[model samples]
Target: MPTLLTRQRWQLLTCLALLLALAAGIGLRAPTPPDEPRFVLAARAMVETGQWLLPHRGSELYAEKPPVFMWIQAATYQVIGNWNLAFLLPSLLAGLATLWLSWDLARRLWNRRIAWWAMLALASCLQFGLMAKRAQIDMVLVALTTLSLWALLRHLLERPNTRLLWVAGFAAGLGTVTKGVGFLPLLVLLPWALWRWKVQLRPGAALPRARSLLWLIPAFLLGTAVWLGPLGIALLNDPSPELQGYARELLFKQTGTRYANAWHHVQPAWYYLQVIATLWLPGSLLLPALLPGWWRRLRRGDSRYWLLLGWALLVLLFFTASPGKREVYIFPMLPALCVAAAPLLPGLLRRPGPRWLLLAYVLVLGAAALGIGAQLLGDGAWAHAQLARRGMPETLLPVLGAWLLGFGIVVLLLAAWLRQRRAGMLAVLTAVLLWNLHGWGLMPALGPYSSSSALMQQVGERIGPSAELGALAWREQNLLQADRPVTDFGFKRPWDEQWHDAGPWLAQAPHNRWLLVLEQAISPCVDRAQAVMIGSANRNRWWLVPGTAWNAACHAELSKDAAAGVDDGD
Candidate 1:
């Protein structure tokens, strides 16, 4: 068995393991909020309307992000004809690509063993696995950035390969289109230039010429033009105020202004330090042993360390300087960090201290899962309250509890069987188990509530076939999950404006029209006596308001209330 598990077989096995872990729940759930539903909604709109250029959330344009990621989702849906799988396919593929890039880059730089370690270390990270499993654009961006960095490193450290440099530049551009941070990989040039200036090169090793580096300009522009060219043409031909505004918002406000003066998600400068320590776990666990080795290599003037570690530091500082901070903002650096740390892991894992720490970490995770499962099964107050707060059905509590308990027992048993010598294997296996449980078990269990599919279905059933449905202050999940066509007032428009418009629309066909309203956005004009209360989903209650529920007498009062509630901010 050991002989059969050669370097190639091990790499192939590792890739398969990652695929199972990441793709476990592809078709089991609908997109849930914070970001998922909005993107999926926009992609669905693109597919339905056949207007692929600009993304829309209900009737309004979604300019908060570029259209590249949504385009991928839309394209995938066109091919596969499955919304669930298509929505998440890009992230899965991107994740696999990212792992391959990390592995291959490490192998080229050092050896296959180091490459395997790099891939495993990265796949075992909490953040990496979390992002890979979601339909978010960050994983795609991470993949692109990793590709760019991998190519650039090869060109800079190994030989003056212009083709690799062009590949790096193009990938960085596509990444920027995915998320504004895509160009981050190009920051490697700064470190590379600094290294060349400061250190002496070997007899045959030489840096690429300045002229060859200039090829990046056209390659980057070509990539950027993939999205920008069409957008610019659309803006010019349409000349609509809305389209023009979208262009400005996406190009400037969402990128430069948001970064320079972030109005939301504002965190202190040291916020990323906390995120790295906690969210980047298991991989981060090796930091104490790896840091000194990294410093020693830096002192010895290793160009590989200079390119990877230096670019990582530049990325850290770039994000740190911004007022706004998110944990995922620094995710693009994880691959490079993993590759840099890979060569040291074998030696570190052989030591007793790191092995003991890995064992303890896994044991603690198993114990926590067991304890929480026990609490839930026992019908503890905290467990019940949590289920109630999330609007999860009480009946599923036992099922969820049993699943967690079983997972904990299996994890503990596996750890005991593997012991400390195979602590790395234990960590990888535990991660796989956790993700599988989350995807196959927990996600599907939570899908009905978390994605608002249950609530939307109820809304559809209550209204019947002949009734028209409209929404005020509706979330993306509400709109996306609706069984029939739903008329939304506007996603970003003020609730008062939506209410004012919705009232008249409901009045137009009094008996046939119904308005689904968010609990907080429901105006005083809505008579609760006539309105039906739909159950909560995504932590917000919903109301199915009939035309008869509208009290026109309260219009003047509602205007005053709306005026009072107005706040000027994004």
Candidate 2:
């Protein structure tokens, strides 16, 4: 077995390597997450109006979420002045920060071996890597949740310090601001309190002293009051009928009741299982083998391990119970699950005679890389030939080839390294992190959403500064801003308001030359001339130059599509 310093040295190296991998992923391309455009547009609206509390875009009420995400977006935009990178930078930082916290937590609980494995597992995972680079609230939630968990676990293991509890409270509060009230401080604290209560009942166990509970009151007040208070006062002072409908639909019904009612019933419980299988990929397979050992440790009175276990379960359950489910929901749970599974790697590689576990991982990942690489290569070659004919540099070919070859090389190296006991463990962790950073972190930002920047510039060239623009979907509103338009369509959660309401407002305004943005799926139904397809990230979005009587044309086209059985793949 590797000594503590030896393991620490390796872990430190792995951390640095993973950081580079993630950095490469971050730097190679600038792609904003899907929601980033919406948030950026809303932040711009804030900057324009000097109304921080009431987020808006033109006539639309843009308060689907609390302002924390928008605030981050606004800050990024304020500094970088580039919408895509600004929106992505915060989430990227959050992802990296979460990885660091996972290492710290792992060190506290088990040892350097487990910590390194856990961080590697997390950094390599498609789930975590992808979400961390996304322009969503999930990364922030993951970081804050991990910080809260680390603080709570630290308090539980050694002493019940009030300062740690306060920090935990602050983290929980911030986590609540990031996502909602479900996962962070609430589900997290409840389990710890109950477990601690049980410990107090034990004969010789020292109950958590009275001082430990003291932080809860201030944390509760400070966390809840800061955001909710201002929102309430703003609503009370100048209550718009628009905000009323929005508040009911977004803050309350959509997030709360819609789940039980099957509103956005995305998938069954098995949906997440499938997502976990693919998203977690090779390392995900090891979880079943690793859980037993960690479970036994927790059961045997290791409170730190217990806390981590509880953290993973609570995050998993939070998403599972939510009515709307998606693959990204499992992202925050990755760090904890990875750490818990880390300890088993050393034994699994050596004891299994090295043929089964490692070979299986390499073979599976290798096949997957080959399949994906083949498609990318064909596309790149065709693109390169076309670019050469057009007398361009055709630079993208080498970059594409390098990525594909790098992925293959990492897979091969990990397989060979795993054959030796010492090298096997190190290679697995290191390779997983590098591959994940490349595959998820680098690819999505570079490939899918990166095209948005070009689209923004192209649209900016065509549109005049005075033209009023509206987005059919709230998401592409940032694209309009990126195009340097003075006024934009509103940000609404359901996004139905723009196609339904904002279209008419822009047409009626003095600004007649209007650019309306719509997703490609919605384009055929938008009966507007001068519509151009921008780019395909997760989905395709478009900007439309609406004619006079735009709303009527839009509705007529939509009705025609409805009759023709054309849906937005709804």
Candidate 3:
């Protein structure tokens, strides 16, 4: 009884739901990364104090990223006390928004088949998929970038709606708040390039005339005003100005000097080439072929093609110039790559002869999987050594092996499906979704981190809900996510285990029993206590309670350290 349109709509909906379900399932239970704990700390600070303009770490105003993720995470934390859930949910939702936007963009430029493949391909990617699971700003960056592209394309090809342009600008502003001001300038180039290309050919088909430049004014103000507006007002109103004294330290010193002057870590330019190649599995290589094809169409007045192309290029350029490079920095480009590649998939599938390029990509993916599996399996001439000393059971080994086998099977299946031109939509979608679920979803969960999860759960029970906990010398945020109030005891560099300054707070804590989650090699201050083996006892005990006789020397050492001035107050 369903019409063809209704069927197609239902199919699209089903695919979307499957993608969301996979993302949510994988993300919800996954361990929070080290960086996530920092975000939670910031968010907790935000909620406790109603200063949306300034990002804080406890009482100190922390100058890292703008307050976007902190605000959202804090808001989410208000509903759910679980900081991991708060951080994970917003990013996960952002990823879902990206998928939906990619599908809609692809559908407009190409066919439904390509749209389905594009969305699935994007959702399946290891890097993007993992980002969705992690509580970070990268997912939000991608979502904003994707939405801006969608709006820019709509403006260029369809009607030049003022609302869309303004919205795009606002999204870019929001993205700036989320991350830094990386891709904000690309707004001008996107629609401008489209208009220029159209103008060179014929006047009638061109984008909104030169008068449309008026939109940029409101766009800039609105985009920046969301966060900076409040910041400016706060700075102006301060009687005892904290920002005024450190004006140089806050702005140019941190952003410009940190990257350009090489005050931080630097890698070779070729670093990102390697990052993009393997971070997202085998499909990442497809970008080289996809870029040129998309460019040709874009130059020929295919609005979406060029808009995405511009956005993707801008992201790459932004990160390439940035000295503060990390694997996740290029995340904004993934959705654009998906959009660029999707249009070509149907044609590639319909081709008679087997595409060598496609096979090559699959083989590369398989090789990457094999290499990773080798590293994980541990040291040996054949098997190689990895986390072997952790004494992980042999039963867990097959999880990686099974993943490799599945990757191989998917390559063959996709190749066969492409050759026969059958299950074109369903096959690609299934392959991408499955790959994402396994590679990004299962892989992060099944590693040493999973063992840590077990440890945290046991520790959480012993520590109780109200016990005051502190990370003595641990970097694992997952342990912090356990339902307990945990603080850092300043075990990190420059401030080594400052328990003296932290002593007053420890004494003031409601619970007498202190849980010390120490790193593998380091030993906590000795006394009476039983440790619940979270992952492995020797490996690093979880749910560990320290004795009444805490080490006085350790506290003295921490107190004398110059950097430990903030104490447990920090």
Residue 341 local lDDT, model 2: 71
Better of 1 and 2 by TM-score: 1
Candidates, ranked, lDDT = 1, 2, 3
In model 3, residue pairs whose N, Cα or C atoms come closer than 3 Å (at least 3 residues apart or on different chains), thus clashing, are: 378-384, 378-385, 378-386, 379-384, 379-385, 380-384, 455-534
Model 2 stretches with alpha carbons more than 4 Å out: 1-12, 25-30, 57-59, 79-85, 182-185, 188-205, 209-211, 298-302, 353-355, 379-402, 417-451, 460-482, 486-570
For residues 296-376, write the lDDT of model 3, one tens digit per residue: 787676556656666677667766886667788777778777777877866655654324544555555556665655544
C-alpha lDDT (0 to 100) for residue 179 of candidate 3 = 72
Whole-model Cα lDDT of every candidate shown, in order? 0.88, 0.61, 0.61
Q: What is the Å distance of residue 72 in model 3 from its true position? A: 1.6
Q: Which candidate leads the pack in TM-score? A: 1
Cα lDDT, model 3, residue 565: 36
Best by lDDT: 1
Candidate 2 residues 153-232, lDDT tens each?
67766566778887777777766655665235445555666566554344664446656666766775566565767777
lDDT string, candidate 1, 1-570, tens digits: 677668568767877877898999889998987788889999999989999999998998898999999999999999999988898899999999999999999999999889989999998889999999899999999999999899888888778898998898899888888899899988999988888888888788777786788888888877788899899899879999989999999999999999999888899989998999888888777788999999999888889999999999999999999998889999999999999999999999999989888898899989999998898789699988887887778887898898899999999999999989999999999888988888888888888899999999999899898899998878889889998899988877777887778888988888999999877777888888999988888777889999988876676435564534422222
Error of 3 at 219 (Å): 2.9
